[model samples]
Target chain A: MTAVPNGHDGLITARGLYLSFGAIPALVDVDIDLWPGEVLAVVGESGSGKTTLLNVLSGRVAPDAGAVLYTDPEGEQHDVHTMPAPALRTLHRSDWGFVHQDPKQNLRMNVSAGGNVGERLMARGARHYGTIRAEAIDWLTQVEIDADRVDDLPRTFSGGMLQRLQIARTLVTHPRLVFMDEPTGGLDVSVQARLLDLIRTLVARLGIAAVLVTHDIAVARLLAHRIAVMQRGRVVETGLTDQVLDDPQHAYTQLLVSSVLQV
Target chain B: MIRTEGLAKTFTLHLRGGMQLPVFSGIDLTVHSGECVVLSGPSGAGKSTLMRSLYGNYRAGAGHIWIRHHGGMVDIAASEPRIVLAVRRETLVYVSQFLRVVPRVSTLDIVADEPITRGIAPDEARDMAGSLLLRLNIPRRMHGIPPATFSGGEQQRVNVARGFIAAHPILLLDEPTASLDAENRSVVVGMIQEAKARGTAVVAICHDADVRAAIADRLYPLSPAREAA
Candidate 1:
């Protein structure tokens, strides 16, 4: 299937993606695409295969059928699942980033916050220590963390600070695409708002394409330009975030949206 | 500019056991730069539905809506969500009959919000908001206060101010002067003409014949019709 229009720049394209785990289908004939500088949110209830789809699309999980194709900013196409392990690892450390749902799962708890942010740059071959440190401090400040805490261990930071530190580390390499799984999950309301705001601002400022996996409709509405509603291993509906959420066409989507508690 | 061919819309009432309601069909409407086209007909004519569909508020059941965005023709009916958002930001804008905003947001912020989001300086955006409020006859004293407690006419003026602040290429006004008095209605009519003079294509639904005569470049009539049995 065709992705975005000709005038638009392409980022990622997936076709007929099917996967299973011991007879439990995780993705069934899934087809998705992404354009640069756009955020596409995947939303559904727990156990809907939202996370599985994200993992497969990011090349962390192998699909039983179909392929995930990514076009770099240099105008080169790379098949995500077919690349060599070192090639894929290099791609992950450089051109792509994946943000786990839990901060602890993403960060080095014992490492200094500065080191956490600088390590990605080091992997990308930023040779100058002073420059890496300066960039780390800049990223910490960008995520609203104080520069004085650059050397503090991440385990000592609050939930919000830990999440922000993880984000800073993920974004330090100037990755062209990021796959985030509930970046604001398991946080206080105010902290979630602030972190989501930072993610929104950074994503917009950097023009990074993203596939965000979230169950929160409000979060999707705030951060995503488009949305894909997953239900039991299939994307039941996909369209503009406002259009799909506002006027859901699928029956399952209608029920899912209506079930949200109104604040 | 905006153009549509064979555009149609239908609503399926889920609560009514899936009964389908066809709103309109076979409509060919076009509005060019420096022009205003008004949708004219009776109450059940689907004028509001047509306007909302054109603004990408409702998904069209059939046909194409070709809108000029970023110097290209974008069919909003079929384009992806990112493309639609770009169109709304740069080309298409809509001012509904009512003002819907966050609670306790001052009228000045409501009016200034558009340009500020478009990267205009906050102070300059506020200044533009003040001038537009004053031009709409909304007193400067009321700018800092929320429009929630204001009368319907005043609120409509705030929406008008917000809609015009960004100078988008196309505009859709739905019942802009329904609650306005004779004098303020003329003020809005004048503002609309000014926008048209600035090469803004407009599609509006105004019941007032005088207002229609004053600003309408053409009338696209839509009346309810029976479907084939």
Candidate 2:
């Protein structure tokens, strides 16, 4: 467990979180704090409970123990664990944006790229077509995808481009906190570099806090301000990206850093 | 090796005034075995159209495509529709970027269908599918779950697993890794490397330089004028 840092407003807090499926524990005794305008990378190997922690924070999976505390833009702290379904849905729609490991799951694959972005605005009741399209195009441009592909189905775009479109769709809603799970996992190495660069730029420009869950240390190093290393549902280490990566105190952190082939 | 000579595809789009638009015309290219070739271009550059022609998804308006398989050289352009279908089903596999998971199908069944459809025993197909799922890191519990219920990355992995099950020698991927996180991307790249190592001739359509740089051994840029050539 890592203590919450001071001064910055805490946007999301998880204390003593525990989750299990059947006889297997996915996460246990996990505590994390996300501050405004900070990008926190959650790193772990496969089945290391990184995705479970993300699901708990985003209200997709209920924790068997403890609480997920989230502060809305209005400065009200709500226990995500206990929120009513409808209230949680509302909070998800208005305040939180989630990007899945696969862009297609987050995006409506049948619709055009613009429609995917516009769907978010429409969900919040922006019905005027032209206004929605304009806003969608603006977001697409921001994400570095061509605005011309707005009418093309996501099926037509390349893998890296589709990821950019997904980013555009999520950010179009202007959510305060974005949760990205392995945002660049399946791209080619060069595309991965470019997409990571785009995410770094957009997170800073939008001033949106993000919790990035990934298994790649290099990805965390590129995009995250703070890094939390997890193993078997426990937060093994958490600190500034440089401190944790360069001078890892925990043995697990040291092992993780050591595994990377330093160029 | 696969070679296209003056292959062309065109579609007439009916506008409000009933005018026509030509989508693509006169494309020529060649792909050799033991090589990974990437087709790159902006939107509407006919990259997908050209790739589709190789598999006979669309009839070529002119010229021909010759594919040298183990048995003999076949004119893909002039092959019978049924023959083309059989060829695509048995020898060529295409993994589109946007996953097309059939409705009401379990993940295991979806993957196993590749082998079963091609005449493998159901039991053997199931065993093979299980092995692939394991290699792809999809949990055993998820094997029986409907693909619709799985997350995006999970579905994509299932899709890849299915595509590779047949051990098709020529695999066509249309932006397979788009929108995936770094871990998933690495997994997909690794899968491609494995496929290549298995002697699959991979033709991938991608715009992301990183993706091409990661997997492509050769690159072909598709421009309107170059497509005419």
Chain A TM-scores in order: 0.96, 0.96
Q: Estimate each model's TM-score.
A: 0.84, 0.53
User: Model 2 - which docking category?
Assistant: incorrect
Fraction of true inter-chain Cα contacts (below 8 Å) kept per model?
Answer: 0.26, 0.00
Backbone clash count, each prediction separately = 0, 16
lDDT of 2 by residue, A1-263 (tens): 35643323588887888888889989888888887877899998899999989988898988999888888777788888788889998877878899887998888889999999999899999999999999999998988888888899999899999999988988888888999999989898878867886787678667788999999988888777778899888898876664467546566776677788844
lDDT score, candidate 1 = 0.88
Q: In order, what lDDT does every prediction score? A: 0.88, 0.80
lDDT of 1 by residue, B64-174 (tens): 999998889999888767778889998899999988664556899878877877888889999999999999999989999989899999999889888988789899999
Best model number under lDDT: 1
Measured against the true two-chain complex, the DockQ scores of the candidates, in the order shown, are 0.31, 0.01
lDDT of 1 by residue, A1-263 (tens): 24543323578888889988888998998889888888999999999999999999889999999998888768887889998889889989998998988889878888999999999999998989999999999999999899999999997899989989999999999899999999888998878867876887788778888999999988998889889999989998998887787667777877877888976
